[model samples]
Target: MALEDVSLHIEPEDIYGIIGMSGAGKSTLIRCINLLEKPVAGEILIDGNCIFRKFGKFFENNNEPELMLQGAELRNLRRQIGMIFQSHNLLMQKTVSQNIAFPMEIAGAPKHEIDKRVSELLEVVNLADKVANYPSQLSGGQRQRVSIARAMANMPKILLCDEPTSALDSLTTNQILDLLWDLNQDYKVTIVMITHEIELVKRICNKVAVIDRTRVVDQGEIGQVLLNPSMEITKQLLSGSRGTRG
Candidate 1:
């Protein structure tokens, strides 16, 4: 239900991944990173700055902390981190460009700057032609691409993605993966992808952390924990694919 003592170090420009079985608290960790789901304890740091310092140290019966980011501090810190969900939480009523512009508008960016960034992101995502389109008018993969564009609108240093590829078919999954990989290379953004699929990690992530029972059981380079897996869950994750390959 909650992550416990999970500490992860995602290198800059690395495609880091978090994987586990359902109810393993991986999602909770992702939510915590973005401050979407407040934690009772521990602090989230981005590039040596404590973006959110939560204080539920002992998991008391509904007691709260005295200090953490608030108002402008919280809002400013949140701007540095961007999040996308598996469901592609886009504004159905807005056009693709408008959806990507939502965050900038909220931040009070000038209309000219918003127009410039929206145009740039559309090209980066290869959805320039779909700028006038709505979420309902695009394919699943296209919709996710738009979401990725939106997530990068502010040029965040870190991107938090929760099962962004879970809704796509195999071919489209790879396409989205390629786009993410390109984003990492081009923008030098650190990407943290959360998923249940081991193959997804193997294919894209250079580093990974495995979560189980609200705790991180394994974490390291892909070759270590994933390729030559040491933990039971890691072995189990590789088992099906290994079996298939064998």
Candidate 2:
């Protein structure tokens, strides 16, 4: 899942989409941003501060040269970057409220604070009435909503979603997309979404990158990339995405 010379510029609060066929490194790219999967080389900066930087085999945290974040430092940094997976990844045995409160609990927030935050997040995801339900008691879309609330529990500045709606039906997909869009608009959370559905990108993303063979072959403003594509893979993806939606 290593990438080469893959560079993309994503602006603040942008719903940036990364589109590629299966095995094209889209998911890996998303994971790399959050350091779930570390890059072999390159720098990842957040708010213009270099959090991760590598040169050849050496890894360094830019704030302190020749140092790498470990233990609580790494965990604290990851808190500001939330991740949503294709699988909802909810705890099947935990109630929706408990699941959403997990991150806050881990962060050592008081029980009252966790409860308050969980209630607010549930309302944001429109699942307030399902607070006591377990993952097993919810539908696919509902489960995804729980995951979204959990990801937002710590009020992350950035959200990395890996095909968050791919498992749902068309109508459900649209619902999830709308929820994500609202989150971006309301909270101004930067979002990086990986999807094969170009239509999804068209509906929400302001910028896009097309990856091919572990390399970014096309990227830019969504409209510009779609209307004036420069690569065959981008063209093919645009065509196939249209055919699927049509």
Candidate 3:
């Protein structure tokens, strides 16, 4: 969690990948964007506004001043930027449709809109038939698809994935990756993914960033970085040379 001087701009509608071995700070980097782990020193701008500049100071003062947003600003930002993790993270008791509808329900979307959106999203993720199934009844890939549908329920502008395919078998991994590619094409949603699998980045990411020891060692177009890695750490990662797996 010691990210140092890491800075990058993700363009609109771009699929950016962060690649590194374990303990390489990839997860920390993404978490920093949402201030999940505040950087000791750095600016985090979202949509050109510096959200983290005074975060620490604001929390420290604790004036409890009546302010705008009612803490919903941060929640709204998170809603617009969806996240998927290595674990499917579905609620055990919720049905597939219920899981996909969870976010919209939290946001208080009207019932009609929620129903329409959930149906369309289930079809998009090819999980329409599993709407009534519980998490325990679905395969790993199906579970992940349910998670994806849930993440997209709010129509996020950006999607963050953390080692999304690490647990799946090779064939399921490929199918999931292809599904992600299709999602990107159809929705034009900006994606930022963290994974140790370089091949996944090659297949889906347009831009890549290599991190090591809490620092970004390399960043560029995937083709350029893969073909001619500039940093030693980047070379090691791209060459399939494992550092500690983080």
Which model scores highest in lDDT?
Answer: 2
lDDT over C-alpha atoms for residue 2 of model 3: 85
Tens digits of lDDT, candidate 1, 161-195: 99998888989999999999998999998999999
For candidate 3, write residues 55-146 as lDDT tens digits: 23435654433222226787887788888889999999999999999989999999999999999999999988998999999999999989
Candidate topping TM-score: 2
Work out the TM-score per prediction: 0.91, 0.93, 0.90
lDDT tens digits by residue: candidate 2, 1-246: 778887787889999999988778899899887778887777778888776776654434334453355678789988888789999999988999999999889889999999999999999999999999889999999999999989999999999999999899999999999999999999999999999888899999999999989899999999999999999988888888746434
Name every residue pair that clashes in candidate 1: 40-56, 41-56
lDDT of 3: 0.83
Model 3 lDDT, residue 125, Cα: 91
Error of 2 at 77 (Å): 0.9
Better of 1 and 2 by TM-score: 2
Please identify model 2 stretches exceeding 4 Å from their true place. Answer: 57-67, 242-246
Ranking by lDDT: 2, 1, 3
